[model samples]
Target: MILYDEIKTLSDKYEERLKSQIEKRVSEMDGDDLSHHILYQVLGVTSEEGHDIDVYQNKGRFLYKYAGSFLEEAAKLCIKSKFPDSATTRVDNTLGVRPKKFEIDMLVPDGNAIEIKWRDATTDGDHITKEHTRLRVIHAAGYKPVRVMFYYPNRTQAQKIQKVLQDLYNALDGYYYYGDSAWDFIREYTSVDLYKILEKIAEVKTGGK
Candidate 1:
């Protein structure tokens, strides 16, 4: 329950951050308050024939796509700040591929695989299954101290996944986090505020945009 409370606070803070970003963008649109307009545009973009159109108008989709990677970077940074060792937090590292292949989000110094997902619909059961396989294979290879942790935001679509993943993680001796619970996991590992890290990343990214 404490984890749920932490997650709620973190989710509220994250929503505020998003609202702030939208307000800033609207202000930049010649003070037109086009946040709603932008939202409409974001929801309007669509993929055709399994290919998405790459255009400036699709900035919303682009942001949504990059959010997961950005969160991974934030988590990696938090871990490195606490560890201060390059080898402690490796991002997007390919471990091994013999009987099965494994590419992970973050490889902790303790040999834990941390897979971060951000409410993307594409990251469904199949994705979880693959990651589970990778973890099992890695564990079988005498990888001591091996663990897999999944972090994802809580959304309407994620309710079922949260249940499914809880069972999967339990069976694997791993952990699954959703909503504010994920913030608890990050805090447990690094004692850093993920929301703050994400805010800084957003600032830097907006400058480039």
Candidate 2:
């Protein structure tokens, strides 16, 4: 329960940071960033519409960043509550030359190496190559590679990449969990129902309860 309170405080802090940053950006946009409207006008988008678009996009960037970070930190807290000695670790990429090392999000002493992601929405095909090498490195390091992704990709190409990654994980005898499954995996393994607590917090914050 104390950990849940910590997550709630973290959510508030992130929300405040988001609001302050957005306000600063919007104010700066009033005089300095308006030149982008010329290009938008050439593309037939009005200045008013362009300004709205920029604001929306800017807000989206911050929201996504904060959301991802909050979930990861919260998940870490939940996991640490169960695995007191678990920690984030770096393992050398023995199978590759370019990537020096791979960062494992959570490494329990029992050899479960977790890679946490809020989402993987990249359409880049090379993401697979990088991930393959990383998993291979983790596997070679005598650790079981596990992926716990809170959200799945929405676009078709991104989904396809995720599918391939899932297959790769399976091939390497690793574990993969996405969306609801990722949350459940944490709950089952850590004995902490983070998803439920998060839902309750959201309801209370948004006055939707």
Candidate 3:
């Protein structure tokens, strides 16, 4: 079974860290920081009015960074609980000069090269090239690249990027699982239902609602 207590502890720690960061950022929102939002200024948004937007934008960044990290680690716990021999490894990027190595989130004894992600909303075209190189290297190393992304992006551009990635993976003999399918894949492959564990923890957080 997966460690629910450890997952809960991780969630709590992330929450506290996020809270502390937000408090620190908001406290330090001085005149210089508040006055530099060019688009907000062009929209006739006063510094006082822009404060809310700045706060939320900063909060969004923190949330995005932490959310991805928390879910990836949680998924690792679930997978490693089932396959204790699995581990992360860095492979040489034979095709790239910039990124000399690509980090595989998990490498199982059976040759599954796992790439865990909570969400991917990248609209950058260069990201596709980097991922292609990464996958080619993985295939060259005899590991089947498998992407497990728990959440699907909401925006249209992001969805298009993901579609392209999915096609790239299939073309290269890699696997891509996202949204509900990703969760199901982990459950079936690892024999651990990650969604149920997170849902129960969330219920406790939301007062059992």
> How many clashes show up per model?
1, 0, 0
For residues 67-108, write the lDDT of model 3, one tens digit per residue: 789999989988898899999999988887878899999999
The regions of model 3 sitting more than 4 angstroms off are 30-47
TM-score of 1: 0.53
Q: Rank the candidates by lDDT, best first.
A: 2, 3, 1
Candidates in order have lDDT scores of: 0.53, 0.90, 0.89
Model 2 gets an lDDT of 0.90
User: What stretches of model 2 exceed 4 Å from their correct place?
Assistant: 38-44
Error of 2 at 99 (Å): 2.1
Candidate with better lDDT, 2 vs 3 = 2
**Alpha-carbon shift of residue 83 in model 2 (angstroms):** 0.2
Q: Which lDDT value does model 2 have at 14? A: 85
Better by TM-score, candidate 3 or 1: 3
List, residue by residue over 1-209, the lDDT tens digit for candidate 1: 33334434454555566556655654554443334444446677433311223223344644564455445555666666666543333222245443334555565656565666655444376766665566565455434222223345356555565566567666766666766777777777777776655555556547636
Stretches of candidate 1 above 4 Å error?
A: 1-57, 84-100, 123-125, 142-158, 197-209
